[model samples]
Target chain A: MMQMADRIKLKVLDPGLLTTVQDSGRWGYQAFGVSPGGVMDEYAAELTNLLVGNPPDAALLEITLKGPTLRFEEEGWVALGGADCGATLDGKPVPNWSAFYGRAGSTLILGFVREGCRAYLTCAGGFDVPLVMGSRSTYLRAKIGGFQGRPLQEGDVLEGINLVEARDEPGKIVESIRPERDSDLPLTQSSTITLPPSLIPRYGSPILLRVLLGPQEDMFEPEGVETFFNSPYRISHEADRMGYRLEGPKINHRGKADIVSDALAKGAIQVPGHGMPIVMMADHQTTGGYPKLGTVILADQYLLAQGKPGDEVLFFPCTEEEAIVAWKERRDHLSLVRAYVDRLWRKYA
Target chain B: MSVSENPSVRFLAMGEACVVVEFGNTIDPEVNERVHRLARCLQNLLSRPEATTYQGTFYRQEYRSWSEVARAGIRELVPTYRSLAVYFDPLEVKRQALEAQITQLLQEIDVPEPAGALEAEAGSQREKTFPRQGKTVIIPVCYGGEYGPDLAFVAQHTGLSEEEVVKIHTSRTYRVYMLGFLPGFPYLGGMDERIATPRLETPRTRIPAGSVGIAGTQTGFYPMESPGGWRIIGRTPIKAFDPFSDTPFLLFPGDFVQFKSIGEGEYRKIEESGGRP
Candidate 1:
């Protein structure tokens, strides 16, 4: 087996719609007006890391609707999760929620996403981006963190840490250091990971999300609340990383739909004077002035992030206890995935 | 506000992981004082290793058990004008139980109301007993030049001379209610009524950072280049936010602010010196 290099570089050939580096989230600085920006699909992003045997909070590339074309400069392992982007490695199809080996000069091309709005790509060692304020999530507005605090562009090079085991040599223990790729040397067999069928998320339309009625629920009329719960809202084209603007029945309010500006939490369904509901997302502003009817539960917020324009969404009101139970179940599922992945990697790798 | 020995604060669940504690409906300083106090208390309770050390008696038994879970569950406590939003992890604690415990904890802590608050009506103002404690930071500004693009518009809207407008603005000490909308952007309270100007009919595409502006009764400076409707009156040389700096923010919530007139030469000198203050 040929030794792999300590440092792996990824050269961007085509920067998709918007590919930003993200982790779990930037925490503890919201009080200072900094948003907890991170990957929109937490489940997908974390799953990608798990497939590559990376830490749960490891930094990964968040690819938007359109996908980027990247060329690997060194041998390493990588995994793709989230939206199905019809990925291909060196002209061969790459399946979602699975890890695959990449040799030097191999190109990874992610085409148009057919399912969700965003996808996540994780390298075994994670991206070598500096953490700002305890995270590598890119907050483009402030131009802070992740690859110069901006989206990936063509010609940009990203560094990755070496976090995988060294390739074995036949009947000998050679130096761990990896030699540069040369045309003269015979190539070694590359490793691959096949995820269980159950691990894959089913990307469906007309997603339903659970929500809990809120701090400003009293401001809305009973009919307004009814409309919010009963009707299906369509995601507007104006939606972005900050929030998803929805078009549906107008939510009537008892008074003006403005309040003294207050701190905002992710998933807040804020309705302005115009009555359209805007569900705050990963890159939402720290504070808001509009009255919120409810907040989508943490367990189901990832569904909202995965929705694309024209996607329909129905909100179901759930008790606080139900939300907590749902969140716990999701966490348990993640733990199960971690345990399963570890066993699989040990046996197969 | 007669201390009725009842927890007057209303706790509303924002979601499984977040809850908003509403102290009062309006933006009263007394209510804001209680909000901040509760935030600090909650932070202390969750950050401390032991909950038995808490002296509050209302939920003594609940605190002992809940604090253990809260020590690792609580993520953020954000204090607004009249409320506090507690963001926590649902994996560690149940929401209904945590809400009840939080209500008990708030009831135990005594909030000092304004003098004669009990007899005061909704519109009537009471004597402020809990005055906010903050430092008065003097910000230097260069008004009515290339830096202040909408200075004439503000003057025209207020129907006051340019010099009188500056005098009215610099005279009052405004309170920094909160930093939001943009990083380090202060939501200043207490602008002079005489100089109040309506927001522009159409917001400009770009307002440079540190451009002081007036919108209705509010006055604030832009912390970064953003689209805004506020009528620009002056420009400050102080860099309100710097991501790379040790203290990224120049001003924070509860800080007092005042403006001092400066010339272009002084503005240039301060900008060249890194615009620390």
Candidate 2:
């Protein structure tokens, strides 16, 4: 158990629309019908953790469209990534994908999202929460894990495990990014380090998601497959962490719509008897009965996660080799950013 | 029978990370057994360092690196009725290499025929031939009245008495095909066709946990309270899933379950005693 003194505290002034503590995901227990609930956008979550120098799997608060208003009880490094939620610290604008130091008693307000659906808020030491089934992610349906197994509410006090010592050295490194700025406070005052513009993902309209034809592609007709790729689908209002119900051209099946329920992989586009496709997301059930037409590639799942309700989505077919190449490219880009951050830390601290 | 004749196996890509090994399309016990056998084999091979040889065939030295990465990459193995979905990290292990390894394993490994198949052919004496039969679990259920709201409906629909419905339901042991829909919810097979009833026209907003129900040829119980369309027949005191417990799930795929009819009094007693029926 960590000592109370070694933890930094944050009080929830106003809980966002849907905010929960999330890590990588809950694995191993899917066989027992457990859903691997986690942050919607893995890319952004990883970047936020990397920005704050937290462990890769460290838990962070995943804020939805409307962001949270939190008061820093102690001084610590914080990073906001994914969606541009118009974050402000002490009434001053704070840039996304940037690591910044927060002074004690400073209020951080994240307003309505202007770019993407979800935003990630990561601190230097990560959120201090008990691990349920080897994860800190909140599975709302089961009411297990996360902060009391539910969304954060007003008056909730969250503790962050203080892994990094708040010495003047690391603070000075953060201040070096904007040394030209004139400030009333001393040299140890708050400063920000932003990620390169090239590395920052652009959230655009009519999101084109690359998909690989499935484990059950034979279940669908050729015309149905054509219809799936040709037509555009709108993310229905029923969308959530479980899945996105797409309202678009009906994907016709050759025979019966139901198959013997099988393991539902993430990003599986299951078209039921009604002919509408429902793309399974982070909190999808372990197994399902509907026939899957295709699965969105691993690299594009984060792009799909950033899409909000009523967002236009177009599916484009890609080969397995193409999917692997796309995944490798994403990995290479992240590695570059990681190396760059490590160099900065090594040089200054 | 030697069981050497291979079933129709297809390696399917469920994106870059997962590979679905489908044994066959139907929900046959033999196919399901193969699925579980393969799952167990992969789990042992991946987790144990010393498990180099499976069924006497030693894996080649060239595939050593692949196995090493597979140990870390292979995140989850989900076994359904006739398929095993292997979720691996694509960055760590390539899908092509993983598929090749699994294909080689399938050819080398020998899965036994289902115990039921052998028993039907050679009578009860041949039960000792197979030692890997799934353990049978007995679940006590309080049928009719408030416990089973649809008991009278089922009785009328099936043209049988309510007592007959209960008797038929408890007669044959059912095999757990898979756990899905909800945590610890068992999708049981081998329900009597006579008692097969259609799902409700309107699904109940809240079906109490432990409420057993029948839908078409399927019969299962709700592990947790949620809105469902299955016809409610009875309620059980025992919890199918307890998140906080060491053994979170009460049932797993390939397990056998037998429903025992009990009175409402016994249900209350078990309910009071922490559902130890």
Candidate 3:
């Protein structure tokens, strides 16, 4: 375990909405019924960690819907990422994606965001938190992680280490910084894949996430499958971290519903007796009942996660190879981006 | 390329980090059996010297370079589930050999149930082979007070007096069907048919922890404060679980729980004394 320096007793004074500490996530224990819990927005969480010089997967505080009033007992640097929560520090404005040099005994207050549900606060050297299993992410339902696996409320102290020399400005890494920042926002998410055109999905946009039929996919009739791909569905208000309930024309399996309980996946769109398909999410249980018509590709989970209720989402059938090809292309593009960013940082300077 | 009976079993790449070979679509015994077996097979297929295997044989492989082994490395066992997802960092896990190695293992292990028995007998035989950690704790409950405003209502539904309701409730042993919906909340099974009830039309936003409730042929304890619709007959002083503690839950899958009768005054003493079950 790594001990962080300059530990600050973060008295919440008040925890607004849901304030919990998070990290990349916990994996490899779903058989025990443990949800792979962590930061809902992993891309933002990692970026914030890297900005503060912590390894990308380091643990951080995830402020939900609203932020908390935090008072630092010691001075340190913290990077705020994910959601544009109208953030301001000490009654003045603090920018997102930039590190703030906070002084000792100062109060940091955060407010609500118009677009996203969560905002990440990454301390200088990551939070000095013990990990359960092989991760440090907070599993709220199991109540095991993040300042003891519970939401931060009034009078909670969050601790972290200072391993990085505080950064000066955005630095020469400014190459494409504006575009990168814009991409991180809600508006710029292209309906089409953003990588090299050659790496583009064979399917047409709006992308219909094709799953190579689930084991239970046969339970549904052929028309059920056809309606699934052609028809449009709206996300319901009953959605949360666990899963999203789609509201639309109730899907039918041989014109009947009520499937024998079966296995399910996050993104497995289940057509319950109501015929309305419920798409499972990160916090979905290890097993489930209901006929799962299809699943969203693992690659497009982030896209699905960002979508709010009432957004119209359509499904397009895809081959298993197409899904694998998309994943390989994504990884390759990510590497290219990382390399380009690193070289630009040095060359421009 | 092949399909099996477990309908929802599919490989879902959570992200860049890991892949899950999930089994089942619901809380049925057959689905659960396949899920556990697949998990166990994965543990055996991906054997690493550094991994620390725990009870139930859950193992975590520690790789200095996660990306290499992660590629095709995770598809070690096709074990009768729907499918298994493969995830790894291609930039980090540069070796093509890792994927081939796991694919080789996948083909070698086809009999699915390493614990023994054939694929068809997953439900009945698998549980006997696997050793599940079980606990039996007697919880002291005070019924039919303000803590249990619905106690009389439950009695009326079951066509029994409040006193008789207590007697019947205390007599049977309840199996914790599962621990879900909330942390440590017990989804119990095996309630007497006479006492079965449907949930309320409207749900209470905040049901206190330890609120013993009856809903649809099952009696459960609300291990945490959450919205609920069960008919609450009483409350218990037991903490039920504390995640910070080593053993997070006071109960487990095969645990047997009994409710001992108590009164408001006795309940107060137990609460003030801080006695644990």
Candidate 4:
């Protein structure tokens, strides 16, 4: 049981490269042309929330290559997942893929990311942001959802739900029911634990992405389609939350490289008249006019989202069945991770 | 006017999670209506309590509601001018089962005849208007001056007077074909060819929200401040997108829009009232 508090605030000391509140995504509004803005790395976001004992879609801060410096105004458990940015708490190093309790007035700082570009910082009870279109993810262009519908800036204060932090006393029986604490009292003890190395994602450059052949495969010449699969494309500097523009071999279209603008999937590889591919991301428009040659499977989008500018990407065609099987395997692995985390919490508590 | 009643339709894989039901190769209002019809049919099917559960698992987990259940399995249906993209959860519903269900629903759908073709058969070239189900929103615009920086350019390109440009733009009631690009941004149809203008060579970095612009044969108002290449001729005072409201978007795919000219004073008044006008 958790005591109710009006606000558990996180004062933003430094709003790094780009810090925005994100969840799984905003759904059911794409038909109305709302962009499905959310966390770039779904695996990391969900894992971060899981470690914090929060719902998979609970809102968390999405820290980009450079992470933000935040100070907790209240005692709460926090977890960092995805890219390892060498996060430090009160001058002490904090490990990724783990959950740690932060005392009130403690400062958390994140340095330059070493490998992956994006990471998620999740609080115990999730960020208490208004749910716009069933999500807390920020869509900057529309100025909707998340913390004021924008990225965190200096002087911004984010409020988190006041939930009871798990504190385990030595040799005490594990209680199934957690007792509610007074709202004015702070959590006495905090425990830290990290997932096994095998569970953590390892990022490497020139990432190989599995793509499913398209809704417009016939629109491209066979050689063009072959070129797309065989060649490596470098992500250009034009990459952002909306999409990534890749510089690669010309994928010459059989006809015009345009279509009646249609619904766009999250990882749609769209080629406009210029013959280069643009991989759609979390903040992609609901529909686009460019002919999409293929789509990076939803399960594999985390790989694309982690790739930074100038990172090389090689695509391989995959069947829809294979993609589904991969997704199911990933989902099963996630369930296993959640169970393992719960068991660890029980052992420590 | 010899358009086939049975158009070539295909169920193409958008990805593992989505399947696009494409009706035609080109844009057509008839195809759009069919897309919407299929979407509606699917919506009606998913809303049923029986359809709420999949493979013995309840779609609604917590705070179970009709809307929550409807979001399970098949999550969203994004209808475009020529196709309907159905995004589903492969974990809940298998692709084959979902495809079969959609095929069954497609068979149940009554494909409406092309309204334009029917009108042509009646010996008239007039546009056949569908039964207006939604209210027609009249957006007041302040054309020319600071609000419309490209009004002179548009008039010169169209070889018409500045006033003629405004008159021609407002004369016809445009059908909202679809919403895309940005939130609440409507892809409108029925812009007169006489006033069709080319997009700017260099797109502006920031076109304010409510900017009425012309690009090729299309005319639409920006629902948010965004960079665009369209030639802006005016600006509207209406809040086309309100993300906080129950109905966040002020317009829909089937809605009708008419732009009415207003002076700068009236525009200020409407702006002050927060789109009350």
TM-score of each: 0.87, 0.87, 0.66, 0.86
lDDT by residue for model 4 over A69-137, one digit each (tens)?
999886566789999999998897888888776667989998889898998998766888998878889
User: Model 3 chain A: which ten-residue window has the lowest total lDDT?
Assistant: A186-195
lDDT of 2 by residue, A208-274 (tens): 9999998778888999999999999998998899999989999899899999878998899999999
The docking category that best describes candidate 2 is medium
Q: Write the per-residue lDDT of candidate 3 for residues A1-349, one digit (tens) a residue.
A: 1233444345567787887777767665443345666776555566566554456677888776788788777766567766667766667666665555566666778898555566778775678778776677777666677777788777777777434342322222321222224344222333211122342222112324455466456678787788777888887898877788877776778744654333345667777888788877767765565667777766666555655666677877776557667767665654454454344334322
Please write out the lDDT profile of model 3 over residues B42-153, one tens digit for every residue.
4533564222222222122322233235434453221222333344443344323433333333342333445444543552333333323345779899898888878899
Q: Which stretches of candidate 1 lie above 4 Å from their native place?
A: A1-4, A162-191, B1-7, B41-69, B96-132
DockQ order, best first, reads: 2, 4, 1, 3
Across residues B1-277, which tens digit of lDDT does each residue of candidate 2 receive?
0112354788887888898888888989998987876776677667766554222214446336656867868999899998999999887887777777777667645534436653455323222222245678999999988989999999999999999999999999999887877888888999999999999999999999999999998898998898999989999999888777777777877789999999988899988987754
Clashing pairs in 1: B1-B117, B1-B118
- Ten-residue region with minimum lDDT total, candidate 4 chain A: A169-178
Docking class of 3: incorrect
As for DockQ, the candidate ahead, 3 or 4, is 4
lDDT of 4 at B6: 46
DockQ (CA atoms), all models: 0.55, 0.63, 0.11, 0.60
Report the lDDT tens digits of candidate 1 across residue range A4-86.
45566799999999999999888876766888888898988888887766767889999999999999987666788999899
Candidate 1 per-residue lDDT over residues B148-247, each given as its tens digit:
7777877887798898899999999987776778878888888999988889899999998889999999999998888999999889999988877777
Q: What fraction of the true interface does each of the listed models get right, in terms of native contacts kept?
A: 0.67, 0.73, 0.04, 0.76
